[model samples]
Target: MNDSSADSFSPRLLRQAQEGGYRLINAVSLKEQLERGSIFLVDVRDRADYEAGHIPGAICYPLPLTIQARLFKRWWLKKLLCNEGCTNVVFYCQDVNSLRSDSAARAAVISGFPDVYNYPGGLEDWVSRGLALETGPCCEPEHHL
Candidate 1:
C-alpha cells in the first residue's frame, strides 16, 4: 500500500488504498458496472464543476454538504439505519486528492452503506480517455426568457 498523499495520488496508488476498505473503480470498470446496473456512479464535484460537465447518469451529490448530514442521515437511515445492505455506491471527484470523494466514501461507510467505491482519476482522467460525458442546463433559472 502506498502512503496516503492527498497531493500526489495516482490511479495506481488509489487502487492500493481502495483494497483495504473501499472499492475503487476506474473509467473502464465504471463503464462495465454501469452496463451491469450494479453500481451508482455519484459525482461528488461542486455544483459549478458539475454544471460544466459530468459523467452520464451520475447524480450531483456534493460530498461535503450532503454525504453525512443529508443523504445518509435523512435518506439512507430511514430504512434500517445500521443494517442497510452493502449496495454498490461509486463516488468520483474532480481530483483524487480532493476531500470530496474521500470524505464521501467515509461518510457512506458510516451511514451503513455496504459497498463504497471511489473513482480516483475522476473527471480529469475520464475525459482524457476520450469518454463522452453529459451536460445539463447550467443552473436553476429564475425565469425562462
Candidate 2:
C-alpha cells in the first residue's frame, strides 16, 4: 500500500479532510470500528465492483451517483451520518489511492458531517489483511442512481 504523501491526490484529500477536522482511518483501525459497530461504512466503488465483493456490512453508495445527485444526495448522506446511534461515517473504494473514496469523504465533510472518515486502505487492504467480504448485492438492490 502506498503512503499518502504531500504531493499525491490522496494526501491532498487527506489534508483537506484534516483541515475540516475529519479523520482518516487506516485498515487496522477500520477493522476495529467494524467490530465495534454503530459506524456507517460506505463503499464508494461502482455497483458491479461493490456486488463482486466488499467489506462486510458496507453500504454501496457509488461515488458517481453521489456526484450526479450532489445536492439532494449530499443532504441524504448527511442524514445517514446523523442516524441515531451512528458514531462515524466512513467511505472507501478499491484502493488507498482511489479518488472516488476521497471525493466521497470530502463531500460528506462538506455536507456537515462532523465524524466523517476516509479509509485509505480500502477493500484491497481489507482483503490483504484476511478480512472477510460480502458478495452479491448490497442491502439496496438499485445501487446505481
Candidate 3:
C-alpha cells in the first residue's frame, strides 16, 4: 500500500462527510442494498486492494481520482454516476473509518447525488462478518480508468 500523510481516517472527517449528506451504512445494510440491486457500489481503495478482494459487484474508483474528479472535474464525475440509472450511489473502503471512502462519499454528494451512502463498516467489517467477497479485476474498467 502506498502510504501518504493524507491516507488517514479521522473522526472529524467522518463527521464532515456525514454533514455533507453521506449516510452511514453498516455491513448488513450494505448487503441488503446489494441484494436489492439498482445501487451503484463504489470501492474507493487502491487497485491492488480492490483486485485482491472486494464486496461482490463493487467497481474500483480509487480515492485519489474520486477526490480529483470531485474537486476539479465535477461534471464528468457527476455525469458518470448519475447517468448509471442507479437509485443510489454507495462508497466503501478497506476500513470503516477510512477517510478515503468518506471523502469519496462527500464528493458524491457534492456532485449532486441525492442518494449517496458511505459504508463505513467497510471491507474489514464485511469480512469480519463472514460476508463473501469476490476477487479479480473490476468488471467495469471504464469507471476506474
Q: Say which candidate scores most in lDDT.
A: 2
**Global Cα lDDT for candidate 3:** 0.71
lDDT of 3 by residue, 1-145 (tens): 1111222435665566548776666666678778878578988888889999999989877666554554643445566655645557888898855677777777777777868877776899899999999998854434444
Relative to the unseen true structure, what is the C-alpha lDDT of residue 108 in candidate 3, on a scale of 0 to 100?
75
What's the best-to-worst order under lDDT? Answer: 2, 3, 1
The TM-score leader among the candidates is 3
Candidate 1 backbone collisions, by pair: 86-114
Candidate 2 residue pairs in clash (backbone atoms < 3 Å): none
Per-candidate clashes come to 1, 0, 1
Candidate 3: list runs displaced more than 4 Å. Answer: 1-14, 65-70, 73-75, 82-84, 139-145
For each candidate, give its TM-score against the true structure. Answer: 0.69, 0.76, 0.77
TM-score of 3: 0.77
True lDDT of residue 73, candidate 1: 32
82-111, model 2: which lDDT tens digit per residue?
A: 444455888899986677776777778777
Candidate achieving higher TM-score, 1 or 3: 3
